[model samples]
Target: MQLQELTGYGAAIVAGLVIGLAGGGGSILTVPIFVYLFRIEPVMATTYSLFVVGTTSLVGSVSHILRREVDFRSTATFAVPSFVSVFIARWFLVPAIPDPLLELDGFVLAKQDAILYFFAFVMLFAARGMIRSSEPKADKSAPAEPPRYGLLALDGLAVGLLTGTSGAGGGFLIVPMLVLLAKLPMHRAVATSMLIIAVNSFVGFLGDLHRNDLNWRFLLEFTLFSTGGILIGIYLAQFVAPMPLKRGFGWFVLVVAGYIIVQEILTSRSML
Candidate 1:
């Protein structure tokens, strides 16, 4: 095939490896691949990202499920509000946002730009958490109590808003919420977030279906490549190291966030 398409597939594989290895970071790479590599528009790139992220996550989650790493009760509790919020965000909140969302003297904020800025901000926030921790540590000194359903529901709602608006799985948000609110161990938290992301992303994709014309040919191919990468990652898991990998991934995320923000600002300036 053409070079761009080949690179797109390669990108999907790398993204999937991230997901498979880390259990969540893969989706963060999807939008950038679509936007910069494939030259898809930001709005549509997010839509496609939901499909790629959701499906690849489903595959990854299945491996975790077979290994019994997934916590079903906690996943269900966190998913309730998250599911609802993501659907609403995609179906209503996103579309209702008018283009040129803001206008001021000599400056204007387009809807696409706003969405991207929100995405970049989320990435930076997530990167900060990862960088600060260096590694996910659960306090095993004390037994984890039963999940506080109320806090889980609230956290899910907020995470759903982030996922729906940005077409991100928001694993960075979900994993921590699972640990803190659901009292899950770090490993279980990551595994459970995969299932939640699969659900939330597909629901968000459904919302996009009503508003956008999908390029199914591209989506399927990209997802398939990503799925293959997940398989490779699963095989490579025995050799993977978490701490250094997480640190490196966090730095990569920070750089990407900076790039997106700078690109948007420069583009907007030119428009003005």
Candidate 2:
């Protein structure tokens, strides 16, 4: 294999390990690796990242399901609305946004910037959610009263729009919502989050497919390496407590967010 191919695969493994350990942060790294490390065009990298993240999340979800940790009903509740919103956003809203005309502020937004800004905002939200203390309630049984469907649907719609546009699974967004809003426990929330990510990612992938923007070589390499790393992560989970991992994951995400912000600043400046 070529040196670049090897590097890409190695990066994928690293990304997967992060995802397996922390849940959402690892997948978010895909775009950066593709753009900075692999020298992929920003537009194409976003598309590629979607496929890679979607596939990895699918595998992770299957494993979680096998362990009987996933809550399908809750996952569907979040994913269904998310899927609808993402489809509309990707197909309609995204296109409708006018490109910068010469008359506009010297700062014109590229499609890439729009996507990156969306990603950074989601990451910040996810990081904040991770750091917040969760007051665990003792109720194991399903709530006597169903949650507000309209509110959950709203969460799904917002998450889906970001996920479709940014190529993220919305796991970071969904996990917190499941726990805080749906009142699921942490582990179940994680498992259900994976399922929601998998569904939204697949839906996003379809939109990318229609655009014919996918880069198969990068996708395959990323999938293979990430899968290996995920296995390693799962094994490590057996020995490590999730709380420490969660804390560590939050810091790691913060670092990534900082880097993305700097990159965006540079990109935006260059456009000036």
Put down candidate 2 lDDT per residue, 114-228, tens digits, no spaces: 6666677767766676666343565658655555556777899998888777777766667667877776777778777767877887777777677665667657867888888
**Tens-digit per-residue lDDT, 1-272, candidate 1:** 87986888898998888777766777888888898889898889999999999999998889889999999988888888898999999888988999999988868898888888988888898788767654546567978677787988888899888888887888877877777778777777878888999998998898888765788998998999999997787677669875466668888999999999999988987877
The whole-model lDDT of each prediction reads: 0.84, 0.73
Tally clashes: model 2: 0
In candidate 2 the C-alpha lDDT for residue 253 amounts to 71
Q: Considering every candidate listed, which one attains the maximal lDDT? A: 1
Alpha-carbon deviation at 177 in model 2, angstroms: 1.8
After superposition, candidate 2 runs with Cα above 4 Å error: 1-8, 101-105, 133-149, 267-272
Best by TM-score: 1
